[model samples]
Target: MSSTAITADATLPDAQPSPTSASRSVAEVLVCLPAIAADALPTVLEAIASAFPGEAVLVASSDPPANASDWPSLELIPYSNARTGVGWVLAVGDYAAAAHLAVERDARAVILLGDDTAPIDAPLLRSLADSVRTKNIDLVLPRFTLGPNDALVNSGLLYPLSRALFGADIHFPLPIDAALSTRLAQRLATSTQRLMALNQGSSLLWPVSEAAAAGLSVREIPAADIAPPAPPQDDFNALFATVAVSLFADIDAKASFWQRARGLPKRPSGQASPPPIAAIEASSEIHSMIETFHLAQDNLQEVWSLVLPPQSRLALKKLSELSPDAFVMEPDLWARIVYDFTLAFHLRTLNRNHLLGAMTPLYLAWVASHLRTVSDDPGRAARAVEITASAFETEKSYIVSRWRWPDRFNP
Candidate 1:
């Protein structure tokens, strides 16, 4: 498509342009920036202009700035259910809106950028677009270089669970910025529509899982250290519960696909490792986390009894006895804890909120143990995460069996 200066509303002139003239204005790439800040617009637009010079690029935003007229390629679009203060990842509404805009413009690819565009540079934008246009990847996720203490929830559960279940070895499944081909955008748009129909328009969309289920190819490009947005609420427990519940629901929805054995994608060579971080003394923090676990063990036993099997309960008991200095939650035990919780979620053993709330302390225990394990040598953090992920992969059969039978008679 040829490049042409267009208005922010994405409309043509009153005098209808011929097919040849209209084709010149058709966007080659539709870059969707949902709830992007006014100040960030210039940076994002500049990046796109630099990345794809001479290509017809359409920049769409839910809330375009008043000065959008200044940018000839801007498009003002409506994104319903746009969330405020909820992290940087694109919402379901954002995906649906982008898909609609892409189809309307007949774009070949779509790049979804988060609210924060400071970390997104021209090269990164080029890489994401090239992955779709040149490499033919259906879904291109960014693998951000995060510190050891950062994104613990993703490291402890999300990554491992997605890796083991979907056989997609994507480092960051829920990324703030990603590129999608037109077909993948359409697929996720249908999902978003269904969610909206069910009044779940505000729910998160697991693009990696969706792509995996659809048998689409996915690739991860290396990204700079981009910090994730803080939780909207101060209550960490509530935050963890929300994410865990959403992921568990997705797993339950795709039970049939994940239950079938599938080969994991090969890990890409020369993966970018996180930069070295200075270790900090976290004894008090670790002690606090462990104390919370001990208290949960004492008080939430009744709730736990309903969710955990006998062997898993016994394992927690053994973990409770360990001294703070020696506290360690084995990877296998942690994996089983996650699997059992997932089963409980699927079986509706109790109130889903309560079930997930009951898991916060256990997750804290794992985090505390993880901190101690890597505190001395921060560089070992990657290796430790690999061991944890491998444990989940090794124990996949455990969850599969429990899911198939769901009999409480297991040891």
Candidate 2:
């Protein structure tokens, strides 16, 4: 897969001049929308207009709306390489095209808005833009309000792993929308180009890891609940495997940075509480998930033996015996299981797909336990999440040791 160039389409006759043309007009902010439906463009444009009034804004889209000429302040630049409508996360091609346009226009800040932009409002847009423009922060990640059962994969593994490894307390590492300073955008562009050169152009980008590796400051702002795009495939196993493989590969790549001993950053004070979510009945779901785990325990012992240590395997055995009402997977035990699997992924203890596939039952088991815990007291959902992440931070030493000496025996 050779590296491909992202060329901007010519400006519409009625629209403003191209940002790359002879005028050389600078844009204060560059907002890149991977894809936008014709009907949704008005809402997006109206939000942008309200958020950034009387300022030059460069709007780049793979699918530009027909009425782009109405917004004189917005100079539309079209690019066609982005993998639009694939998923919520921005693809490598999207970042590459946005970076090219940002550099061309000398924009001070860039906002990468993934496919769904209808939910974004004026204040949210302003917060993302102002963070990069006023403050010196390099990356601004949005923390969306979610229900107790929502984003289980992220809550179970992604948030805790990233928080523990990168020392970033962001609730959502894989966000649909984010704000990036010019320098951070350039850095991401370089990384994307390198991945493209290696024939991994369609791979997902880890912005949090990139920012952490570059020693850039990061901040997470409260955002209204923005719904992520539905999974391209309905299979939960495949989706979990895909996300875990990407994250494990990222962890393996940044081993040097996270291996060193470091203090965890203190949580910000006076944070606003998230709005309440309606309670959901999940007893049936929990029972089904528990059954899945029990089946996997009986069937996948050989595959599990290759990755989990003796103690972790014993822990899972003990957990599988409990009934759904009595089931509870301790945070510490879950952390160790994840660490061992990550090590297995790094060492290639088994086929990567098979390794991640075996993890699905374990993850479902954890989810069942988590939902059971939070269902008893809905208000404790936030505290439960905090405790889970804290356990990961506490167990960081365990992973560091196993990573350094994979062959060493453990109890």
Candidate 3:
């Protein structure tokens, strides 16, 4: 209801954490930091220290500063990073270090804080640990104060897809500051390690999916974090491709669990409303986005024909015919498009990279279509995203039937 943790009743605080279970290591907080420049390290450490004073904080990074004699009760575990980008950063060494600290220190709980995330303070960090230690919760996710325009990818894809597939309602599935019990840490570590061993170290690990599949406890805490805008050098197509590949791969790997997963996401009610975001609908790029989609229609048609049902193909064709002013991708149509793409990804109808790459423009079209449809109100974009997620849930059976009998077909 208030500051949250998405439990049955108004996040996790309403139920109260179990004191007995969390008492084992109250003073220890395993903080996983990202590799940063030397000039910035002290300020970062200070922010953490101020927020969590007098605690044994184990700060792990792929690379840590040398000559760190100044900080007390802070131990450094330097690890080797497996890949680049967020997936590489979070899934590779970062996750392993947290899991290691959780076991070795018999730590009460592990808190993941990213350098690029919004500032973390004492109360927020403590709140995350409290949820785990006091509430005896296994997973603690952050409920951020986001501007509507931020986290578009998470809104469009990660949140809805994860919700429909796993029935986990974490607002930010790939958070930099998530809390975890010992059990969750170990579970994530095992998953991460397998990916590393397979030379798929760049693979992303889905914590919410893992937690849901294992039936582990999960909670949420309030965190003040605003994601920064994309870097100038980041190409839209490439960035979207990376996330799509990871998501599709994750879905394929856990197809069985998601296939059986049912129901809408559990969105907690009554808290501060989200901040306003830019209307994709109003963006000058609608024509550009639509143009991209049309290009894909011409370029990716044969591949699309193989992946999509005839019905889906016809729907996309209709949308392609509309000008930006009139263009709209219905929620159901978008869902089927995504489901078909997921199926295509699984069936390896084309090269995986090219397959995911093809979906990016289609994704942009949906974003444009969604923004065009929703209101300009501060939280309306979120609502639009939510509606899309609901569409995904409603259409999940389509995913199931296709996933189960991918070949025995007609639409």
Best by TM-score: 2
TM-score to native of every candidate shown: 0.87, 0.89, 0.82
By lDDT, the best candidate is: 2
Give lDDT tens digits, candidate 2, residues 168-225.
Answer: 8888898778899888877876777666556555677788888998899888898876
Task: State, as a TM-score between 0 and 1, how close model 3 is to the true structure.
Answer: 0.82
Which of candidates 2 and 3 reaches a greater lDDT?
2
Measured with C-alpha atoms, the lDDT of residue 203 in candidate 1 is 70
All models: lDDT? 0.76, 0.78, 0.69
Compose the digit string of candidate 1's lDDT tens values, residues 113-227.
Answer: 8656354567888889899999999899878776777788988999999999998888778767789988888787667766555555457788999999999989998876555
How do the residues 272-372 of candidate 3 rate in per-residue lDDT, one tens digit apiece?
A: 23223333444676677788899998888877777788988888988889877777787778888888888888888889887887788888888777667
- The whole-model C-alpha lDDT of candidate 3 against the native structure comes to 0.69
Can you rank all candidates by lDDT, best first?
Answer: 2, 1, 3
Clashes of each: 0, 0, 9
Off by over 4 Å in 3: 1-26, 61-83, 86-89, 116-118, 228-233, 265-282
Could you tell me the TM-score of candidate 2? Answer: 0.89
Q: Which whole-number lDDT from 0 to 100 does residue 90 have in model 1?
A: 65
lDDT of 2: 0.78
Candidate 1, pairs of clashing residues: none
